[model samples]
Target: MIPNLDVDLLKTFLAIADTGNFTRAAEEVHKTQSAVSMQMKRLEELVGRPLFTRDGRQSRFTADGERLIEYARRIVNLNDEAVAAFTKPELTGTLRFGTPDDYADRFLPEILARFSRTHPLVTVNVDCAMSPVLYERSRHGELDLALVTACSEIIADEIVRTENLVWVTSQRHSAHMLDTLPVALSHTGCEWRALAVGALERQGRKYRIAYSSPNSNAVNAAVLAGLAVGAIPEICLRPGMRLLSEKDGFPKLSQFRIGIVHRPGRRSSAAEALSRHISESISNMPRQLMAAE
Candidate 1:
């Protein structure tokens, strides 16, 4: 007979793989680094394959690890759906979740991994798009829950997370040129782009879109090259990047609301479970940022 695999252990493995850093992964799962390492050791022993390749300094997913993550996501999601459907929870159908593209690179993966832990049986379909598109989809029933950023006027049924908006620039650039140069932003429908543009207009400053990319990484690349100044989450601006202060002539942008909107009315158990996990994940890493300089 095949040995039984522990679902909780699998969840921990997935977190480690997603973050690629033991410390960060540990924080997500509420475990100590040493405790997480031990869990991985046990999981590898039980699976009978090496899941990760740890070079002296970095950890990488093995081919097996990659395959396992795919299966793990499905397993975790499906399990949650089962608990919701048959048991006291009762949420079996697929959960189509949407989020703004800005979160795609930074937070989505981690959030998904955490959500999967509870709803191991539900299928989670994720859509990353502009806030308007996501909101429209949720309204149309195409999405069960959506995490988006929007102006105060676009109120939602639920507000999930809120974050500080700050100006980001390359450390190599001087502060005086902030308002003079063009800025990098996303396509027009994006909430962040709108906020950035609104702030500039309110200050009576003249600027242009020096560059715009559909992908956040592309925009980050433009700013990294000293191409232009852009507004980004305060959490995302790390030690190696420059934050424009009041002295720099760039006014502090107001905090943006990152809300989680779900279909109005009562929610199914599976949906609630997924939402709870996401909230937990977000809460755990309240202001965690990347140092990708």
Candidate 2:
């Protein structure tokens, strides 16, 4: 008889995968570190394959472990869905959700679709703006929940994802090769703009802000049109954009974080449900960014 995999074990396994550390996974799952290890061992035995291999002090997923992530997420999600459907009251309410324009373009569609399917009666009103604007709205209680890029100036309730910030230019253009680089970026006070300009300054590369806008779509359009080079999170990269690297005389930029913040006090069922969907959807995204060849 085939052994049935335990949902509890799978949850613990997913925590480890999401956190990438046994200690952190234990904290997430509310289990002792040793207990988390034993749970992983049991899971491996059930599957009859080693799930993780140690690299120095860190534990990395093996090929089978990587492959099982999708199956585990689906299984756990379905289990939760069944339990929620039977045990909980149907959620119904209007939720005010805010996010930066760039994040909305890349992540909102999947998050909203999955959430609507689970809570059909919940209405999500999306507001797209700059991160600072969203942060202010969330703090003012005007938005129920906001997803923003984490920056030093604002404190986020929870960080859901992190990725490299890369320089991009049009595939057909030589904008990066220009003597005085032309940059397309968000308006003043944007963290991405600051980072990009600072990096260029440190490299002693002369650059001018050729295009500036609060809208990510406009910035991307300038880059795609080969009018200027722009910096964006790896996940936000478009199909026609080419990455610039140190070899291209571009300095490396640091990783940026995506975080979610909720209004203070009690959260409505709709807000709670959407928050869970956002966290799960983002945490399950591919962690590795595409490298410049």
Candidate 3:
């Protein structure tokens, strides 16, 4: 008899794959780490193959685990789509929404797909830009709601998610060995840029900006090509990049607070519903998917 794989278990498997560790995966699924480990054991038994190997604290995926990810992503998306279509609530009207590029690329598609299924009559006008711009625009009533990357100084209406900041480099790169650490960073005004540079300066570490771009892809490319090292929201770090620790001479960085800011005052029923939907989707997102990759 062929054992039927549970969708929930598959979901958990993908979560582990995404975060590169069982503990982070457990947090995403609202399960204890021990429970996650137990689930993995059960899953491995079902597959009848070893699926993970220890890479320090990281759970490096075995060949089977890697293959399962492609299948898992498809299965989960299809399952979610079916569920959304059947359980949809009737909603209508247009919604003006804004999000930073990072969030937009990572989770918005699935969120919007579900929203479209649940509220077919509602039109969502989405603006994709930097967090600061989105937050400012929403504050001035230009957008009904916005997702912003909240720095310590920027107060937000509500925080929907959080991410640790970490240094990452290409697997083959050793830019940290240079006398002047080469950094791939965002533009001058980006909060992340300011934070990374500040941290380095405070530690008296000399670094040169080897590359700078507003587009995260360009920044990541710089790191991927072994030209430089960069800081990213740990949740968004993709596969192929190795995370560096303080032991590797990288300093600890502040956590990123993902905040939801909505226009002040009463909002339309559609807006309210969509806001709730967006918030839920974001808050429930697994750390791995937050990386646009």
Candidate 4:
């Protein structure tokens, strides 16, 4: 029997719709790009209409795709609600969680909102800081849970995702075109800063640290203001920020890893549950947030 256009298909459709890229949508569902494409083909077959069309590499919704979005969202929401409604215990307790501020601002609300729907009574006290600091605090028991942007060298069983680092500049600024490139980045100990500077030096590219901030907003602000080129994850590049490539004379940077850290040994059920939810929720980020036009 043909599966009844189930919740999984709806979720996949939504991910593709939201991300506009097959690879990204696959990331959301922890599937391979080929699998996502195959599923999309199956969905189109089931609906008996073309749902998407590609313009170059970017996927745009066809009329039929647009029509399905509303229904898909409603069905997915109802499906989730039904599942949560039956889950026992109402999952209550405080989980002391920590994440970097920039990531929190971009991704936390949706994560927490959905988590709350399933575990309505759970209280999540979130601390926003540098990812390294979050890990340190988690190690010392200052936080029950932490999501860290761990440098690739630091392996952890809890690693959830790995993303590439990209060189970027403000679309309004030609800073990267200069003889000595100006850079805006986090203060010392930032993995991006270290990897970026190292890449430049290895390539014999001259650069100066024109702006430094412990806060991500400040670094992005400086870059946005055309003060300097910036190094950040590709997922953080939105319009107004130009992603640099070999054509732009910038060398590639290393990957950044995201992982969960929790207190060693025994942990509260609430904290464990919250940590799992957070890991799953990490990919629920808004599309076009870092996507360049």
lDDT of each: 0.74, 0.89, 0.82, 0.81
Deviation (Å) of 219 in candidate 3: 1.2
In model 4, state the lDDT of residue 164. Answer: 84
* Candidate 3: tens digits of C-alpha lDDT, residues 1-293: 88877788898998887786888999999999999998989888888888898888677889988877777766786687578667866767788999867667676887788678767888999998787778788878899998788876567888888778889999887887889999999888778888899899999999999999878888988899999999988766866798888999889987778888888788787777777677767776655546535
Selected candidate, larger lDDT, 3 vs 4: 3
Better of 1 and 3 by lDDT: 3
What TM-score, over all chains together, does every model reach? Answer: 0.63, 0.84, 0.69, 0.75
Q: Over the stretch 26-108, how does candidate 1's per-residue lDDT look in tens digits?
A: 99999999999899889888889998897888888889877777667657656664664456533457888887666766677
User: lDDT by residue for model 4 over 212-249, one digit each (tens)?
Assistant: 98888888888888989999877667668888898989
Which candidate leads the pack in TM-score?
2
lDDT of model 2, residue 40: 94
Task: Rank by lDDT, highest first.
Answer: 2, 3, 4, 1
Instruction: Per model, state how many residue pairs clash.
Output: 20, 0, 1, 1
Strongest candidate by lDDT: 2
Find the number of clashing residue pairs for candidate 2. Answer: 0
The Cα RMSD of model 4 versus the native structure comes to: 6.8
- Model 4 misplaced regions, further than 4 Å: 1-4, 8-45, 50-78, 152-157, 284-293
Which portions of model 3 miss their true places by more than 4 Å?
1-89, 288-293
